[model samples]
Target chain A: MTARYLALYLPSLATDRIRRAEPGLPRSLPLATWEPFGNRRVLTAVDSAAADVGLRPGQALADAQAIAPDLLLRPADPAGDARALHALALWARRYTPLTAADPPDGLLLDITGCAHLLGGEAALLRDALVRLRQVGITTRGAVAGAAATGAALARARGDNPVVVSGIEAGVVAPLLLGPALRLPQAMLAELARLGLRRVHDLLGQPRGPLARRFGQDLLGRLDGVVGRRRVSIQPAIPPPDLAAIQDLLEPIITRTGIDAVLDRLLEDLCAGLRQAGLGARQITLTAWRVDGAVQEVAIGTGLAMRDPAHLRRLFAERLERLEPDLGFERMALEARATEPMAVAVQPSLAVGGRRDEAAMAVALAQLLDRLGQRLPVHRVAPVASHWPEHAVTAQDPHDVDPTVPPGWAAQPRPVLLLRRPAPLEVVIPLPDGPPSLLRLQGLAHRLHRVEGPLRLEPEWWRNRPNRFRRDYYQVELASGVRLWVCRTGLPGAPRWLLHGHLP
Target chain B: MPSAAPDVPLDQAAVLAALRARVTRLEGFGRAQHNLGAVPVCEGLPLPGGGLARAAVHEVLATTPGCGAAFCAVLLARTGGTILWIATGRDELMAWPPGLARCGLAPASLVIVRAERWPDALWAMEEALRCPAVTGALLALAPPPGGGKLDLTATRRLQLAAEAGGALGLVLRPDAACADHTAAVTRWRIGSLGAGHGLDDPRWQLELLRVRGGRPGGPWAVTWRAATGRLDLDKEATATGATRHAAG
Candidate 1:
């Protein structure tokens, strides 16, 4: 399929990010953000006020300081800027889910089939820029019949934001080669020395000499800018497996109204799943607020389910946490991570068809869904290992395979395992004798009986090169409490640790 | 008042009276009308069917750090399914896998959740008790420095949730003062009775502080063997050992 793209460039993204975050900052102030470069600080971004004072980005801080001494400086946050751009990409999902953040200051969107959704490409670009400006972000956008690279370059350099269909070469020919092609500074300087500055000059020249002189990068970038090569965008989030969208004429703020809308959306989503004979394990509900903000809540079940009431109840637990601005005018429910529904066992009067087990399983799933709000749930399954600590592991409870039996260790382990072995103060009679008294948590206990120091060596190949040997002993205290303690290090100077207990 | 009942037979009247007595005896909401064989330890309790009853809330008080955790964990191990363990305070103080295994519970069958606040821990415990997948839930809540006393209403909600889900709920409270006002079906004060004569027999001083619809007379000398996952009455040992013993 032929790809059409839209590239949005935020020219003042860094300053705009700062301004957006600190809305109270005076616009008249000459603001410049600098970042550390090697041993020096360089201006990474500048506001219009700073630019008017002859300050440019990438200039050394000392040079910029000499020019505008009153410039308000801030440390540049590249990560924060990238996050802001990514957030804008999510906001753009309302127009098209095919959106990607072009790091630092840009967003590349695939608008091939989505243009008509927002009237047209021209209208979409204008509306998008207007919305961004309203959010204090100054933006430049361009649409092209070719790939995202062509639109991105045009937005950065070309006077026209919209390139006419099928006139890619004509539109790209007039732009300066320096801005159009992303080449090394040395190579651009070399091209400038050769009096080759504009795209037309490079186009009119022999292709062989240019390719030989600059290697293939200059030609490759030129090919990309003219639609000869495709440049695709990798979206931040994968599109939902199935989605149900609802547009409301009037926004709803009341809990009952929002819940009703969500209930209807869940029913619609369940209907789709029923038709496909698939159930979703994870469900996400998004509420698009009237103030151009998106609020989303997600829930996951240990088992696949399409029951609308059950899904609604799970969402009901989370609904109070979602604070909508004013109210939400649109809502979307998406089903992700779907699996085939397990065929329900028909209840028989004779055998009972394992009805009790099935009911119990269902009830457990419901309980997990309710408890999922405060904490995550995991299934504990025994693993095939001799080491007491490594004998069992946590698994997703939904992945229940009845044929695979749990593997139990040969040795008996303690009832409660400490997160880590805690040291116990014990008094040993001599170099090799068992401890007569153990002190733990400011209390002393008389050791009643002694057990063998069942020595277990470390799996040196799997762990650190030098590891200590473990000598485990099950000791009974005079208070009737049984504890599992272990000795580590050499036989002569071993440290005792209370590892487990028989509670 | 006599005009409407004049035609009733004497035998029918006697039968009705017997049924009413049975209903009154089984009035506790958490008392198991069925599935009595599911948990054996409850049989020692005064509840109907000679058991502690499934789908009920039980309170265990532990004066020491490790004792209550061990007792509740062993009891939960008796139930065959996932156990949700909600721990309050600095959760680092709670026991992990090997200790749980020694208590006869498979480490894989236990889910540990740490709630920093005691109230959050209680809420999570109630939520977990309402989940059918959780066969049993144990919450270890130390009395908060400020407002940590758990009243009857909070426990009643947990009781209802446990009954609804047919799951047993156990609360490990470190506060002994709030024991009498609890809404739990049974409240037991458990402390270490020290070591027994054998390898697996660990004795505990179990004092049944309160029991609804039954006699509560513990502070009994009982030996708990992890292998059998049951509490054995130590008849030879006198209950006098629990005289100085105290648990929350």
Candidate 2:
């Protein structure tokens, strides 16, 4: 029931990103990335070499160049860094399903029940760091009882890697109030002016005075760090396991040009599924637009399948709905759900003239799949209920169900049943006989012949309200149009409604 | 036994005439087979075959709902393959499963496609006709709420698609659509005959308004036998404003 979190902070993300991308960059050389801040260019990130030369982030680039004259320089890519951080967060889903992107350069993962898989909390953190290091990304990680404290320890405390509660006070004693605590810089400056720079100084102060001075935000965050309050992290939805993503060099703006690229992605995804001996029952194509909006089109099959050609045909029907406004920058084809499937073996004897019976069946399934994606494709299945409203349902054409029979109620049901029954006006010929004329929808119909008043009652155990018990009639007008009408209530008091029309 | 590349142009006039004949044969497959290998329409229509062509488009201008959906349901049962009932939102009043079963369409053999627009409905019908598994595709073609009519070219495309896949295509449009020029092999206008009190057998005052190869004649009061699920032209059946005119 305990919540434990791990925060992974990439300190030199911008500089390290350039180094990792271009391995020829000398790591031993001092390096830093700078970006425009207000009017002047300031350092946004510094590598270990640059830090050792007494250079730091936020320092004027001219001053940093003066301090380490031979420093390697590159422009800071804030957007790319943010994207990489988000991707890393998604990649971290391997350790835990719950992971969030802490922007600027950090990630938070709720490794609660997931810690034991890689041995324990300490071993998991070590494995994570080692793996990211192999990818050439320097990462600092700390696991704590709270996300706030874990974030503070990983980015600001710089001490233990695994700090469960109770030991958090002694560990957090000397740590200064920093950006990771998410405190306003103005408030931190005010506290530092009162000589209360360390977390321990504020921890020992009177809660009432602090509340009066700084409002409740400072106390709420401090309690959150000490494990007194639990704050839940908004984790990103986990990406599908079996998927292929391609970032385009040029955004795709035309539907005509989409097929060549889609075919490649489907091939890649189907290959992965085939290797795992599984087939996708449900798959989705997610197009990330250049304008930062995402459009998703998904298809489902009656049976598990790994055929790229068949899937491509189905996707083509719906791809028209995916608007490439300003074009799509990246796309991913993912199998949202899969099922174990036997590997398909090619029949050695290939003969072709006309399509065979087996091929016809496949064609039928494919047709349903394609049509079902763009519109409502279903078979009308009979439900075993005496109630007219409960007698039928729209069912998927390919779904095999055991409950429904091919036919129900040997009595002829109407060919067209109105979704809502309309009230009918009846003028009976005699006191006991059926109606001779009727008015419906402002049209007066003279009855030519009237069939039986077949009485149907609700189930024995059910509450048979007056309207629930009905006397149904198949009536024919002089114009030869047939209608199914029902009369409820006793002979003394009758209510009529037009139910449906006969073919 | 000659190659499909057509006889070499020996005489320019002869070659041109031969190609014209070939084009007519290809273009009007339905007219060529209007008298042979047709799906029998119960008690023969006024046509020579007493039936309609199998792999061709037939338009029915339903004066009362033009053709009853029940008639199409019976055709689906007789075709003995996967059937598609394509309808737009306004015209999707059929497909009551038990009612379909009552009329003879197998429950497992039917799939309904609801199209949001008129073009999509036409596209779905064309797509269904092209699929080998679909033996029949019936489209309930109501005039789109926004004004758009089915043109001759669209009907021709459907005809070609039907010929390729060996599937039957039936289109039921409102009687108001009778003025549109269509490439269909036959166009029938069916009006509900106001008859006696007995409505068990829906009788229609049917008129074969047009046909490609045959003279169109009807206004024959035909009865749909519920028990046999067949169309019967009964002379003794009482009908209002119906003529017994017949043709072949």
Candidate 3:
């Protein structure tokens, strides 16, 4: 049995309200639609009357009005049109997952496997048309083996829907003519003069002559229409299952209402997460305004969480930061799973259980949210070194090994540590002993009980050159105030400085 | 000198009591589990048992360029489990050593967000701190206008958020001076030390100007070996020993 390929097109279908409202405008009245421009407006669509009167898009509004004094102009709302198209796309999804929008006014659905469910190709087309007409949408549909052929036939052919059987190469080869073939007007006129008006007339001609006269693109388009070439269509990204949405009968204005709606959306989002047996560590909530602008609030968690109340509270903290404007019509919550969480299980009672790390992480996250990034304590690990500055480092509490040794247990270290030891002039009362009187930062301090100097040397294998040596000392003043002081270079190197003190 | 009587080991009950007391003291030192090690803005700090200081803010202010701001930032960032490094204007303000990664900071976990302006950077820092999921510390360069002093109210708000979030915030103030209004728990000045002799280690000096629960002022000499960016105290005896033996 010979196979038959069919492509269905829906033109003038008014998949969008803007296109449906087009025929309603008085034919004699000059009408134009304005679209949004940055902080202003620009013309988008112009009616035949308006075009006849010399009004075009991109012209200043005042100039357009002056050109067509009696023009009936309305502001174009692309967002509303997009929403309507999206709704139509959703509706078309029932027919085929391959359904997509052509933007502004068109939708394409590849109903390869779905036509039989609607009682064959003809019945499916009829059903679609009837459903659209019931919604006050004017539509025209055509079926062919090729997309381009179907689109052309739907646009140029009569209201009687066109249905072509067989593949494009065999069936649509003879039917292409006039604008359906998409040959330029001058080319079509020349073809008509040459007595080759129909695509069939040129099909039998030699390829060399066709290429010599017309461009390769024309032949390519013909090949595309005849299914000899492949075409790729960009599909929309699929939405995740964990989605939260709010539908309001009336637009919400006050912040309180917005908060309530957001809370409800979070609850739904949490429900979705629970249904998927997942938790969200990151969530973005979008407040879609009636004015078409969307305000988004995003929150990230330290650990995966699925609790609705916790999620709601996190969003509430962020919502307090937003200034709602022009009211919102819908609230959407998009939750993305971070790290996979383990399945929840009841704890066994045999062993003494410790606090859950996840709970602690959540508690810490809450603390971080309220405390401004400065409170969660982390341990500073000491590097094995003699230099006071290079010995210790800070690390996050979570990153720190609980089993690691404490910072102070290793050595009797100074209370105060300097970032870098400063150069100071010290007069040693006894040549090798501790300085009796030390001059540091323009101040003289009398030494009392002095400890031995602890020296630190630089690593030689490093690429950078080392210039000095340090000798750190723990000295007690007459008043019993202990200080951690250091001198740079060896004992005879001539440079000694006061580095830091023990607090 | 007369030595004390022979050391005696405490019984199990006494040891348990001592352990309890020590735990109590540690907890008391930091009322909030999150705020331990936080230095205060002023001096005369109350010392907890085991030499631990009470919970207070620690401010590290550096007047020199290209010091240990990055090291301190890495330290501060770890407080929140993760860290958000908000950089504005300058990129190389903080120098993070590789040793910090081994010290408990996961370098990959550090979120470095570059902002266009200081205020925006501050705002991002504030937001990151407010995010519970971030579970990270906030490290931001102080605003250019405040000298070394951040807005008290802003700092207070951040402190409150850090308290609430249990995240530590460390502000790297390059070339910042000590100001009376600055609300940082402890203010410190850190700088790079002169390189040591041949086959020696790199040295650094840190000055604590204001410590909340500890004493401030005076400098501490530290050595940073390139092999392990870890910091060590540069003691006088070590210097004398190295000189005597000609081996460091």
lDDT of all predictions, in order shown?
A: 0.74, 0.77, 0.55
Winner of 2 and 3 under TM-score: 2
The predicted structure with the larger TM-score, 1 or 3, is 1
C-alpha positional error of residue B31 in candidate 2 after TM-score superposition, expressed in Å: 12
True contacts kept of 2: 0.61
lDDT of 2 by residue, A270-317 (tens): 999989878888888878765445677888987677899999988887
Query: Where does the lowest 10-residue lDDT sum fall in candidate 2 chain B?
Result: B239-248
Candidate 3 to native Cα RMSD, angstroms: 13.6
Report chain B TM per candidate. Answer: 0.80, 0.77, 0.63
Please give, for residues A312-411, the per-residue lDDT of candidate 1 as tens digits. 8788778987887688878889896798877541122224657766766676676666666666555566555556566556676554422223445335
- Candidate 1 chain B — worst ten consecutive residues by lDDT sum? B239-248
Please, what are the lDDT tens digits per residue for candidate 2 over residues B123-206? 889989888778889888654463246899999999989887777788877678436898998887777764323446667777
Candidate 1 local lDDT, B1-248, one digit each (tens): 45668666669888876875587446655444434443556334444445555788988887544667777877788888888887667644545555566676666567767676667777788878877667889877755452256788889999888877777788887745545587898888877766677655667777787777667776677777666666788764544444434432
- Candidate 2 ranges beyond 4 A from true positions: A1-152, A155-241, A250-260, A275-277, A287-295, A317-329, A340-355, A400-407, A458-467, A489-493, B1-37, B44-50, B143-148, B193-199, B235-248
Candidate 2, backbone clash total:
6
**RMSD in Å for candidate 2, one decimal?**
12.9
Q: Which stretches in model 3 have alpha-carbon errors above 4 Å?
A: A1-46, A50-99, A103-105, A109-245, A252-260, A278-355, A359-503, B1-29, B32-55, B67-148, B158-171, B174-178, B189-208, B213-248
Winning model by DockQ: 1
lDDT of 2 at A83: 84
